[model samples]
Target: MSKDDDTTQYDGAAGGWGSVRGMLSTFREEADSPAVLRTLMRQNKPGGFMCTSCAWTKPAHPHPFEFCENGAKATLWELTSHRCTPDFFAAHTVGELKGWTDHDLERQGRLTHPMRYDAASDRYLPCSWEDAFEEIGAELAALDPRTAVFYASGHASLETAYLYALFARLYGHNNLPDSSNMCHETTSVALKAVIGAPVGTVAPDDFGQCDAIFFFGQNTGSNSPRFLHTLQECARRGVRIVTFNPVREKGLEVFVNPQHPHEMLTGDGTRISCQYHQVTAGGDIAAMLGLCKHLIAEDDRLRADGRPGVLDHGFIAEHTIGFAEFAAMARNTTWEAIEAASGLARAALLDAAGVYMAAERTIGIYGMGLTQHVHGFENVAGFVNLLLLKGNIGRPGAGISPVRGHSNVQGQRTVGITEKPELAPMDKYRELFGFEPPGETGMNTVDACEGILAGRVKAFVGLGGNFLRAIPEQAAMEQAWTALRLTVQIATKLNRSHLINGRVAFLLPCRGRAEEDVQESGPQTVTMEDSLSRIHGSFSTHEPASPHLLSELAIVAGLAKATLPPNPKVRWDDWTADYAAVRDLIEATYPDQFKDFNKRVFTPGGFHRRNTARDRIWKTGSGKAVFTTPTMLSATSIADAPGRYRLITLRSNDQFNTTIYGYSDRLRGIEGRRNVLLINPRDIERAGLADGQVVALESDAGDGTHREVAGLMVTPFDLPDGCLAGYYPELNPLVPLWLHDIHSKTPASKAVPVRIRS
Candidate 1:
């Protein structure tokens, strides 16, 4: 465990006393305030509000302290004592605030009231909620509804997102964009096409039954700490864990279950990953294909032995189609091609294949690493193909697990927040609302930016999220925002997006997950669906962070009322009075699955929602699981330009998405800085660069669009050759708007071709 020049020591294990120390510091600095402590104490507890961190599922039987380090940070962030009132905005001009980093803007704390940009003074001034709504309504009503872009964040509850989508459609537009369009759209695209569902089918309980688990491209420790407990349990039970990623994540190496006091105090933790391999950037597809090839060869060998071969022929024949074509393609694949692309020795893949062959049941866990490439959809297919060959789907202890971001990203999609509205859902809407929904496909995140730059999008409405910060091609996105006639953000706190104004800009403060939302009917509770498809209610016991702030659901209702004319079928007032009314509508729309939605969601641990894939029922044109034959590409195929290195954007251990909790990445041992790029030692030497040397990165965007970020300190680390990693938002510029996956349209953030210079 040697320390790099930047003091980034190779972390042997994740989460010991250091995690406890970070938790305590977060409590003191961010959550020690009166309201914050009261709210934090009740958060993630039974019957309390769900933590607004990553969508890691909660245990059915919760302990007293159910939160983790990042979870606590998210809670403190939402319930922080600091407030940004009118006076704070009045003192700082937009020009001055524009220079501030995203970390500094959010650290100032919760937004207390609605505000509007005062063009005359270049500062934001307090505006009444009523006047703010009226101004937005007037602007939106004046513009062509098709030109209005509606953006959604995963921070909102199912009720809020469902309501927001309904309002946007009722306003006569379906330009709905969401965070998933950037992160997991590829997973959705692949899953829907292959398995007939947009979500995962595996529940947390299945971890206990799994014999082997494959970590395709996920950092479970930092992104999802609670899941590590299950990993530790599997480790104790002698389950095999194989990881395929470009970075040597500490979590995948070893982990200390914080729930276990012995491991926390003694610094002795369960060793998690039995075997770890670093794939080249965008190399997951090749690595997975290599594994599949080895499995096929092993099956052929066992079949010759007159024994039970690894191939589940019975299941494949009865439950799937097109396998013969896939097997032919997989057998034709060469070992040299896979080794060169995956950056792993043939022996390693063969060893991992042996482990897979020995196990009776297995699961493949993946994150953005597998889904943020040009062939991301194909990468997903590769993993699923391996599992399908072994009969993993629709069985206990097996299936695809997409570790999702945002507490309710899955829930929002389930409640019908989508750009591609289908005919069936449209029919349901017409039956309920007495109006026909839009028929054409709408803009996604990247498409919305295209709409903006083309001068087709006039007004932008965001439910919650730092849209301006999260998107790729930041410089272009900012230009697009400036050209828009109107921009409105409904959010809990102030962010840099508010400063990236349009011709007219307004900020509507709303209640966060940790605050109570009192409605006309009574104190209301909202539901959040976890990554496992469990729908559960979350009620905040603490009072609102500020009385001036309204609930997100209420904001959506208010916007609907202010903008849309009354319809006898759609009752905005009734939906706002009681959230249950919204649930009723959702259940009535998706009756087969969401039947008794309100009652089921309130059940202890929340009832698991039905996914057709879980029952081995394929709703596709094939009427069965369809094997996909994808042409495998080189790992660095996207980095085609000469002297170009593939840049993979990442979030530090201290950060979540664009929210900077602090300047440290505990697992990587980085401290007090975000202006550094991680590079392989040999790669740095080849580029004629020394450790700690300042350098610049230039995008391979041959298009007229210029993209680069300079003044970054280079630090040598263990990584795939010709591949570099850096924190996101800083490196997002290198990913041009035009560079994306052709299938899913997701930003190819993981493998943007870039040149490093002195």
Candidate 2:
């Protein structure tokens, strides 16, 4: 590969020398302290801070290096010496800063002081914390509770989330929308309806007990590289691995363990997946229907021959309902529709089904790929249907695992950062805090943006996130953001969202997870819950980025104290001084889930939260796991037209959710740019376009909106003919705010209809 060429073929295994180079380069470029490597060694250990990257679990018997490449990058990125101080803000105006790129804005580094946007000067000037809080309090007090939106991100800890949730409820309404509403809300919605639990059922040790593992829509190498170690161990033990994704991922094919001496010395890696099927975008339901149909048909044949069939008939009869209706729908779905929708032959699905039938125990893992679509709820139900057929639930080595992003995302939701009225304990809140809670449901992410645009929402408060940059309709939302009367952002670093100011905006700097947090209680540790429902304490030994920075706990407490009149039931000062007071409140609210929360969280390896679904006890109205049927084979029904393709928004190996680490996507062999479009070679030839030609993409939503992005370089890759891939936030404009899942309201970022023009 040369500097002129932006794309190249990466033939090496994922997580060998390539990962080593990536980690070292990040450290060399970002680290200010010579002891950064020693700091990295403490990550995920018993008394160390949790890696702030993903929700991947730590092993009971930990290895010397438990962290992954992304974890190292997150640590170094947080601990960088570069500072976005008051001087930097003083030099740049809001209009001038908006012209800069997202990467460059964050590259200016950690925000050191609290700043307020000045309309006259059009620049952010430093302000005292008390004055800033007082102004926000006055603005919020003047507005109706229903008109204010309180948003939270996945980065907040359990203690902070618990306090934040209470703060909003105490003020008035439940307009609490968090990051979970965007990514895995589909999984939570569908799983709760079918299995009576909103979270996954598998534990870490289940990987070793399963005879086979099925992966859907998840990219293990980039999103959660720590999972690659488990996959490598399973592959070495002859566990059959099957994968279904739109793009062929290297992490699922093979992985080289950097920690293993033999592999690092000899450059030998273990072969991972036995079968990989490239399912088309929005085709997961059809593919899953194909698998279910095959297994049911095979069972009928075996039962007629008077032998034991593959279906778990006894389990179905004893513990499930709606089996006949669900099976009928699966059988009614024709193979032709499945083939066209999934872009896979009947033989491929049959082969994967055969692996599932032969195994006594299996685990299914998925990521945002299946959940960020219009019919994402149906896609999740399809996965549960496959697992239910073999009695895979509530058994050893068999369950569903929704690999999540952000360390405490699931934990935040567990502690109650939701918009639904039923999910919150309104009566308990009244009893505990001596206030009557609002009974009406509140706004989600999509609804919040619509509210802001419609002038119904007057204020916005963000705990920690780039809300404008992470959502769809980026240009429209950024423009509409100025309509709000107040905007308060509590953050550690400067992102593009800081530039999109409202009439009165305040940016309050907070402590990062990698920095030590000391309260009146001396030292404090926050808790995080992984994808497996295990709770653990996380603490850092490093100094704060700035001496003026406050903890997230203190910031939330301060805001609550300033906003509302003093109430006898609430003790904001006491809770802020000691986090255990907050934990005691949490345990009292969800007694079964967080019993003895403070004592158990600090112990080695932490504790596992109770999930009744793991014990075959469904918490639904039926008291048993239910089955669901899918009505549609595809998510969208755009008229088939020439040059039409489904555009999938992707994250590079150098990127996290909305944070761009660098310009290079090392795993895909792309360098120095992110404005390149990945298209099939056949599609490029059919469209009469050359490999390196500049092209544009126009979205087709049938809503009379003209959405197009130009100046994209076309690069040929191996994929289905009518599918294209590009990075997110860059491609967010092509998706409309109204295009989302009907049930979950999650923006459909995975599948957008578009046409390519050269």
Candidate 3:
């Protein structure tokens, strides 16, 4: 077998001995022994810190080691002994540091103290906390608040995110764009309009009861390895598991739970997907429509025979709207169009629908594959429409699950890190803080970039994230990023965003999730909400990497205190000292969701915020769930020219979002390399490209500019014909800023029109 088939040919599973070996390799590289081991043990446990990895739900019951291989890497990556100190900065100028790779910068380790950019020497100089705060405050106070963008990353806790929202609102603008804008914004927009709530209805317990679970564009092995354990259990119970993705990812194939004693001892694994359908890039909406159409046709056939209808007619009539129109649209859709758009035959779609019909309950889980497209909003809505047809929502083991990447991207949105102003509770703010938040809509990630480019947006305050590296159009963004008057990053370590400094930039060092945060009240616990909507407290028993590092809560409060003039309504000092004060404000702002903020979160396993849709209660404008119809076959038109290929950007097994851990992707058998493209053998031959041939990918959006990324090697793999896959951020430059979902404004990273060149 070839190197690409290592996962299937060697171990035949994702998380067997390979996971253990990877964890050990990371620990050795980090060079921290018992301390890192202890930290890993406490991950996702009560009174323990949350994993800095992906936001798969934490189990209600306890485990000795709840973290996965990549989760362990994240924790150790934070706890590394290396530190980026004043001396290190003095050695390297800003220009010199800009040339360093992202992995090299992060490997330099934690930021020890606050540093301010010295333009004269082109180096960062350590600055006193008071001076840094006062200067940042002065800059903010001088600029019009409307022009300043306050961005937050998933690394922040609920308490810190709440403070960030309050500070941004009090500072007089709602330019609170966050990490979600680049990721699951499509899900938030679609689900809220369809079901009245932005979050999913299913909980961790639902996995046990689910008779069938369908995955779309989600690579579970790398993004969320812990989820493989849940799938393993379901597969063992004879539950039907189906997958639809452009790439034949090993995660969706088979898995062996590293924690299972029997599997570990015997070196055996469980099969994951019963039916794996390789849909074309930008073809999820078409595949989703095909499934819906198949079910509708089956229902008509069953009814013609005077038997029970295949679709849940009672559920549709009582709890949903626009069923007749939706059914008509599906019935009108032809199988030829579906096959051409989806790159799947009618037989395959019908076979998948048969699995859906056999199960009493089901869940639809998706990831970036479904969202980062031109019609991402429609893609998500289509998924929901299929579940609604089968009445697979609002009951045990049934619902839609958008498996979020970041640890708390969903939590940040819950606590008000959004561009939409109407989502904020204005009346509640008036009753509690005696100040009205900005009523006008603010900018999202893409909008903020455009604003920066146009000189409309001045300063930027980032809670935690490498915003410059995570977004699309990297080259253009790098040029536009210099327009900012000031940039403040509250983070634990160095990232590419730190290198893209403004005229006045400050890097404020903050404690990591694995480090204990001590405030006036004592060692404090931060709360985070999982993708499943369960709010839980995270405590760190490990010592801080640097004594000078402050908690995110303290840093945000200090920034607010310096920027805004003293106000009796907002207690920045008290909230900084005691985090409970922040929680109290959050409860007041969102009483319905967070009534007992302090008590419930601190309790073991935390409490799940009520999802009204889970109880068959739709809070939409029509007071009922609405069925949506897509007017098109797919997000983007199929590639017409022979050499033209649809591009899909993916994260390697060794990386987490923009953070690259190593060059080796063990599952895919790619070692010591990331700048390579995965293509099908047929496509490679048709394009006249040889295996391991160096090539360039160029994209034309019909604008004068032709975006291109060169020096990428071609590696033929299991990708569908007329489709090519490359690593993200590396290929983000090919994605034009204007090419995005119109509703959510999420960059179309998944389905870019491109042609390969030798």
lDDT of 3 by residue, 40-140 (tens): 88898877779988998787676788999889889989999888999999999989988888899998999999999998999999999999999999999
TM-score of 1: 0.98
Number of the top-ranking candidate, with lDDT as the measure: 2
Query: For model 2, how does the per-residue alpha-carbon lDDT over 560-621 read when each residue is reduced to its tens digit?
Result: 99999999889999998888888899999999899999888766666889888888999877
Which has the better lDDT: candidate 1, or candidate 2? 2
TM-score of each: 0.98, 0.98, 0.98
lDDT for 209 in candidate 1 is: 92
Instruction: Count backbone overlaps in model 2.
Output: 0
C-alpha lDDT of residue 567 in model 1? 95
Per-model C-alpha lDDT, please?
0.84, 0.88, 0.87
lDDT of 1 at 658: 83
Total backbone collisions, model 1: 0
For model 1, how does the per-residue alpha-carbon lDDT over 1-758 read when each residue is reduced to its tens digit?
24855335545578777777777777777665576666666666557778999998877777667777888888888878788888898789999999988888998889998989888899999989889888888888888888998899988888888888888888887788899899999988889998888888798778989999998888887898878877888999999999988898888889887777888778898889899999888887778888888888878888899987888999999989889998888789899988988889999989888888888899889999988888888888888888899889888999889999988888887877788877237888888898978877888999998888788899899988899888888887887678889999988777878998898999999988887888899989899888989888888867677889888888888888888888988888899999999989889888886889887666666778898898899877788887888876452345455588888899887878889888878788777888888888788778889888999898875676668899999887788888888998878878887777778788988888888878
C-alpha lDDT (0 to 100) for residue 435 of candidate 1: 90
